[model samples]
Target: MSERTGWDRRLRVRADGKGLVGHAGVVLLRRCADQVGLTGALAAVLPVGVGHGWRERAAVVVQLAVAIALGAVNLSEAEQLALHHRNLFGPAASDSTTRRTLAALDESALTRMAKARRTVRRHVWSLLHLRPGGFPWLSVAGRRLKGWIVVDMDATVITAASKKERAAATF
Candidate 1:
């Protein structure tokens, strides 16, 4: 397998479906982070050696994020990214290392991290603006708003089983 920076191995699409890696789509997310400069921007804001020899704290954070996107609830579960797909994703930081990295983040570091994310977001939006459609528009109340994006941060709750006698079943 050929090695690539950011990605451990080059990925190819196959129609026959001879070999498939489960959860391989996470690679795309990692690639997106690398392409959009999220990885580098985060690394710039976060301190080096925070993971104690992991080298790239940004990668650890990104990996953890990817794992969470894949339904990982904790840091130990994030290790599955490397454990199962070592070829697609290179070495991953241990939970302890990840804990250290997170612990190293002070208020100032978090502020810097937020700033870095905003910077990368702006850069990505600028690139989108250069696209053929000239960025996407949001419509509200039949009015098209240019250069606007709406994000809905709503909370959702799901109950598996309730002990209450009068509880209704949720599908």
Candidate 2:
């Protein structure tokens, strides 16, 4: 019998060695964990006590994963990519599981996380040690030139849609 085998190219994990860190999957997992609580992540479910009912948090991650993959519409297709690349269990999520999980969230945890993130951006500016215009978005032209920063808003692609209509408002 030959000493070598076809499995030589296969990757193997070291049971006693350290595992991968800072990988995309690990980073995404950390973000999801922050969205829900760490405890919620381990459980992959939680109750917001907001009258919606029990909510499963893993779907939050799966849905985002699907979006990041791009062009994944149905749950099954999303699950396939999630399973192959991220090694997250996709086939385990059926339509019903997804539906119930969604129904369970009063508002999407993902959306809440997004909103919370926006608020957090302003927190840095609130620090006492940082004076006005010291945070860097401000320029040193305060006394010599325009002190205010101009913010431009455009909605060329943003739209508001409802179930009754595909797009209620578009810009």
Candidate 3:
């Protein structure tokens, strides 16, 4: 199969087979260290809930990197897509393992991970690059368009089973 080219390269996306986690993560992390203060930033990043021995916990990073690589980008999809690609990462994980890992990364854990990594932060801000110019594609009105971005958020409802938990704020 020849490498993807032309418009297919632009809109429809696919992985390069190079693992997105280790190498891509190193690149991204370095960019982050440059823009934001490294120690302070890393330290400031809260834990994604309790770390689980780095074995089962490895899923956190793998899932995240792959999801970002594929542009699914949301936590739920991140969890789902991560499961879908587990074999690509090596060592086939049973559907149950995937479910358990994802369940462990439940809302609270995801919030902590997002908080600790400042996952929502811009790469330019995190990497220290001044945000890119000329509307991602460069057209007449593209200049005025929002460039290089993805907006994400999460919400949960605590049923009557838990009276201690309550909606903090209203939109």
Candidate 4:
């Protein structure tokens, strides 16, 4: 079929009981996350009954992941997703709530969380039919070579808009 361009079709608004979803794609991604057993894994790792009214660990992690995937630079930006479907998406977590949740986690909790994350990663990789081994071969300048991936993590200087404890010129 030939591709059609421009606004050939007219747009209309339907005021039905159906709600509008801003990050609709994220909902699909959440389903995939659920399929990969992320929720159960996170529940096993994270502390229980810690959040009085705060969202659960699995929900918070998925929400944060969705926000990050949608190009949210900070935790406060999660409100953008929550605003569209507050009822369907569950309770919206404030920036302070997210911060406090992370801060309250001890070393043991952190370790468990990491292990759970690793399990989720492995499950996702398996679902995508990706093998765990050496890097795939890449063609460069018409020559095939086993590609090697390198990651560099370095601290950079940034000016904070507000005063923060231990805030320095560089991290």
The clash numbers for all candidates, in the given order, read 0, 0, 3, 0
Q: Which digits, one per residue and each the tens of the lDDT, describe model 3 over residues 145-171?
A: 445443333434444343456745433
Q: Distance from true position, residue 126, model 1, in Å?
A: 0.9
- Tell me how far the alpha carbon of residue 29 in candidate 2 is from the true structure, in angstroms, after superposition: 9.2
lDDT of each model, Cα atoms only?
0.77, 0.45, 0.45, 0.65
My TM-score estimates for the predictions, one after another, are 0.69, 0.33, 0.34, 0.58
Instruction: Select the stronger candidate by lDDT from 2 and 3.
Output: 3
Error of 1 at 39 (Å): 0.2
Model 4: which ten-residue window has the lowest total lDDT?
Answer: 2-11
**What residue pairs are clashing in model 3?**
35-128, 45-116, 46-116
Candidate 2 residue pairs in backbone clash: none
Query: Considering TM-score, where higher is better, how would the candidates rank from best to worst?
Result: 1, 4, 3, 2
Give lDDT tens digits, candidate 4, residues 133-157. Answer: 5434566698776444332335436
lDDT: worst 10-residue window of model 3: 2-11
Residue ranges of candidate 4 with Cα displaced over 4 Å: 1-17, 50-54, 127-171
Can you write out model 1's per-residue Cα lDDT over 114-150, one digit (the tens) per residue?
9999999999988977899765578879989976765
Say which candidate scores most in TM-score: 1
Off by over 4 Å in 2: 1-69, 86-95, 107-115, 120-171
Give the lowest summed-lDDT range of ten residues in model 2: 2-11
> Candidate 2 deviates by what RMSD?
15.2
